[model samples]
Target: MSLAELIDQPEFGHHESPRHQTRRVLLLGNDDRVLLAVARGLGRNGISVDVAWCDPDSPALKSQYVHAFHSVVPYSPHDDQWLDGLHRLVKQYDYDLVIPCNDYAVVPLQLEREKLDPDTHWYLINDDAFQVAFDKAKTSRVASELGINVPRECEITDADVRSGFSNREFSLPDRRSLRFPVYVKPRSSITASDVTNKRSAQRVDSPDALAEYLIHEFPHDGVLIQESFSGVGIGVEILAHQGKVLMQIQHQRLRETIDGGSTYRETIAELPELTEATRKLVQHLNYTGVGMFEFRYNRETGDWVFLEINARFWGSLPLAIAAKANFPFALYELLVKGQTNFHTNHTIGVRCRNLINDLRAFRHQKAEEFDLENLLFGKDYLDFYAPDDWRPQLATLVHFARSVLGKFTRRIGFSV
Candidate 1:
């Protein structure tokens, strides 16, 4: 039978002998891919999954593993109505746990943990530590103090803000200090409520480009201007309870978007430097739940520079699951079962691709380092095309087409 047909089969959630208890989990995030992966991961392990998202047509809604779906206020820094809605859902459904899958959702929940139902368990870092992690500048300073390598950064000045697209050429305190091709990004990873065009990071080749971006693109926003590191992006995903790490998995980005987001990545054996750095950071924060520490591996120096910590499930979570890390299930066990037999070891060299976004990368011609031949013929795990749950894959295609059409219509002065 086809995967779609099998989604409705009676045996979908009827495991003969369940490994984990049947606890209802409410997952929060708009990223359907991450939601779908978590749903399947926990659902198959005998946990009931419910999803709350802003988009009604999200692919996670189509997953058979999701017992219920609810539309809540979209992720925003200032909005707290979603919390009220979530409280009602928790009271109504008596969900055993609440999991926020993105930083946008994670931060708000962390800030208002007291407002949430005390009976409902949520694994998250404390607000004080999260504050340090959320801000790039603060994170870099803390990591550096901890004896971890971090990209050199300069403080933004009031003069820089006042310059604001002026004719006067702007210059840094130490003009010769920074190498060319530095990155200019928001000081804090969280997007401001008033900001319309949100960006992760921008690479600026010249000082002129850097000044122009800060003045024009994000005039009112606080930004970090840092010396860009030349290296490959590596993510070390860890699941911790209190101050102790339960599991850690490493993945190397093979290809990413033009700006800087992983599209293709593969599981790799843990490196001592990367592993040690991650442990130090996580322990320092006394973080609970799942977090991924991103690093830049300088090929020439063999040094690992700490980037930032994502205090929630990351985009490439499915890749970790595909390599047998099973973070979602591990999280469920930790939060609900009170203990877990968490395993850190995972199969190395197992590649995982987000096919839809990979296509976007291919369209932009950005992933030059990726071998087209390997993408075509090599054995790999696909994020969306799961054998037991194929409908989300189809949903992804439809969503992509609709998005492209929407962009086209807007360009041509039409509306869809």
Candidate 2:
């Protein structure tokens, strides 16, 4: 039987008829691996998936699962063009659901929620909840109130901006109370409008370096000076509806890129303390849809410190799906069918790696010797290498090659 026919059968448990009813989803953001995984998952479940992205050559655009592709201006907090284009696409295609794949897309969509097609549903947290989750300072304060451990941080205020110290070199403050190697990052998540100098996070050894970074790197942006937490990164992903948790999974980071992004991770049993803290935080925020709570677990202290919450689909979504969490399908059922029937029990010890980024991580590690065979066989899953869908992987490789070539040409004072 055909795929549609199978989905329509009584045994398949889908309520919609393949001939008369088909759910449509419009996913925002294009370059992310999570976006491609979401499209493939929803498409296989009989949903007509459409894609919107800023780049014409994004990996998701090459996926066969995408029924249509629309080019929109990249996400920015002040851009109305993207919002207008999204509304037009929803009206044009009569999309049943709209899901933002990243924080850049989520913030604007939440801010302009009422301006879009009201009939169309969104897989997003409420505006108030989004505000709490988006700001790192606010998230830390709230999580701490719920008895969750969070790193101590000091917020840079307008007063600090006016102190003239922002322009002048300054010495370190008293080091008696503060720890060395504190981290400095934006108070809120980075948006597309931020320039290259405005990084997500930077580690500073002394107060002078912190002051220098605040002046040079993020002079205008609000920043948080947080104590550096030493530990392994753990992510607790939860899918919820109106404060009720539907599915949850936990993964431990095994390797990270030079920039501190996860490259290799494995599913693991949920830690009770971490799980309870996540539940309390999500429930307090009344968050809806999919969210991931990141933490730093110190093995010596047995402390799980809250990092921040991603209020949308995460980059490591494929690992969760591969381990049998099936977040994409659960989201579809929750939004379209008014109920979710997926199990949250995922297989532990299943490792997933983003092969390209893992290479970067490996280079950063600089081992004495390399073991090619062990590296190839150790990973249970790769983020973008499915046998059935080859085009996206090919597209990503081409994209990476072109990027490298462009950088090389620029360095050599030539243009191609």
Candidate 3:
């Protein structure tokens, strides 16, 4: 059956018939690339997409895919006030699904589930699951419990801060036998925010440097200190419904924006290790939602060590779509149609190029190692620049133009 025919069945839950249900998704965080990709994907499936954002003049507001736009003051999703606004919005229009694009929104949205209509679906990993997913320390504990291979780590909380240069400090941990080049990062943080709640990490070669960094930088709200693993990065994206994994795909990172972050990037090819770990994690969590599991292929053991799971839809979704596992459509089926015949094994050979980071990766590669063909025409990763639709694409173009003009006008002493 055609995808539309499958989704239109009575068992899928839309009594309004296919045409009426086609355009009924409400998307939060309108500016997020994942939301845009999700919206575009849903729109393609005959779903009408509406957007709400703190920034009304968001470039997304102009998208033809978006049916209506709501202006909201930027507020942390963690706050109760944001939930109140969401409740009011829900009362006015029954949004079939609520998708949070950033990490900061994941926890609060999950916790405040009671405020939403019972019939309205949200695809976040459960609250307890999210606590583990968002916090590195908690994730390490859970992985150990689940027998998943991961790094050994400890969390340094605000209480860990101690006074003076005393040898009897309560905050210090015995690091005599721990491996050198240990990695440190925040145990918890909100979206696009400061890296350190109060403390930062400097890779320490000696015990004194570790002690000094902990004493100085991590007088902390939250931070994680763990053994560093060397490996090729791989990501597995999946969709779960009723706690069952419905679709899965794995992709290797050919480039990254940060040393260990997914700010922007592209894919190389599907990695077997990443695909397996993604399945293992979703099974362990008994999770129901759109999730991505990241793994670092440890060179030391020649195995992929579980890193952390994004308990919500992720940033590189377009790449996943281009690579042949369209998670957004799978999610729409679950939320709108409640369909379960959701299995696929499509793969797109993706390569993200022209992005600032991908450009850097290209420059880093030696001439003989570089393949110039994929750079010109996308071999794998989806570039926001390439669009199947003209309206949202034009909207993005105008938005980018205004951004450049705003910067130029500021340089010329004009107030924006």
Candidate 4:
């Protein structure tokens, strides 16, 4: 049987026949602002939600938007214990859907599909989904296969790590023809967070520098060397249903914590080509969830090469929600209503805000990153904690206070 089919089989002991029904959904990766926003969106739309994560300060735990909250060690979604936990939680609550808002959470959940409630459907892609999106080498290959534009690249392996940085016959010698100033990234075993701390990657201006990076910094294997694309980085958020894209929202980074790093200030954009390209790629993958496609514009090549695909909800979700393309609501509709008769027609303006308190390190490095005016008074997106409901609004304030106190204590001598 195919991987998607195998993973899609009902595991709750019975099936509900995919009917339009109000659902009790579980949201994972709790402390994430994106996940909190998703839960708020779903809750506002009347879908009951429960939250689980490792952090005590998970806003979902204290937020009025959630039905219940659980804190525990974040186990590998691939681990049987994780599956057991999921099964127990779903059985205990009789949840009908599981919505994961983080990439790490999605992969393991997809791997252990047999543990999910059969009555529950997951708003996620399958193992092949990870194969196509998260793994950079595989993503490039698959994009190339579909005639989708990707960087010309070569993979570096463990053998390359053992050998000194010499272009010998044992190595893929065909990379000799590639031009200088190529971008070298680890094929696997590294993440965005690694790039900030590790001196592994180098902007090699020549083959010697590439060899140097390989010898000293990038000693680990599973790397990729690709033609560097330098352009204004734009991200596209998409909601897809069984290979069809239902909504697309684009954003252009105004500023970020690190040069050529993740965004701290972004504005909604209108890019038809990006939207269409992301739509086509997801359709080919038969994606049935929320996803983001990150692309870097290469001024030299004048092409937008595919960078990565985030298979779950993305960071700038409130921006999309403000623009009327509500991903969380859409996922809820798919699981509960089965279809939404709604159409988005809102144009959310620019926004700039701090990353969630849990992302303290990022926010600390870039505390003054945002345009204060835009962050404080933007009419575009609603602040996650600034609820219109008085009760919930107070709860949000309390959550913020606790988060600040926790960070303050951590700053002193206490470990967070």
Q: Comparing candidate 3 with candidate 4, which one achieves the higher TM-score?
A: 3
Instruction: Residues 1-416, candidate 1: write the lDDT tens digits.
Output: 86545433332233223223457788887776788788888988888887775356676667778777776765455666767777777777666788887765676677667777777677577887788888877887788889998877765655667756465344455564567788886866555453233457788888778767766776354777777788899999988987788898898998788888888899988888988888888888887888889999977889768888887888898898888888999888887778856656689998988888887887787545655666678477778867787777777777677789998989888542
What are the lDDT figures for the candidates, one per model? 0.76, 0.74, 0.61, 0.63
- Report clash pairs, candidate 2: none
* lDDT at residue 240 of model 4 (Cα atoms): 74
* Over 4 Å off, model 2: 1-21, 73-80, 164-176, 191-199, 219-221, 367-375, 402-416
Candidate 3 RMSD computed on C-alpha atoms after optimal superposition onto the true structure: 7.9
lDDT of 2 by residue, 1-416 (tens): 85333322221112232222567887886446888788877877788877776355566656667676676665555657766776666766676788888765676677767777778787667887888887777887798788888886776765676675644343223333557778776777654464212247777888678667766666364777778888999999989988878899999988876556788889987788999889998889887789899999987889768888888899998888778788887888888788855666789988887777877787888745444564567546777767676666666666677789999989888643
Model 1 stretches with alpha carbons more than 4 Å out? 1-21, 74-80, 157-160, 163-176, 192-197, 219-221, 366-378, 401-416
Global local distance difference test of model 4: 0.63
Model 1 lDDT, full chain set: 0.76
- TM-score of candidate 4 relative to the true fold: 0.74
Total backbone collisions for each predicted model? 0, 0, 15, 5
List model 3 lDDT by residue over 285-345, tens digit each.
Answer: 7777888887787556777678777777776776766655667778777776788777686
Best by lDDT: 1
Of the pair 1 and 2, which is ahead by lDDT? 1
In Å, residue 64's CA in model 4 sits off its true spot by 2.1
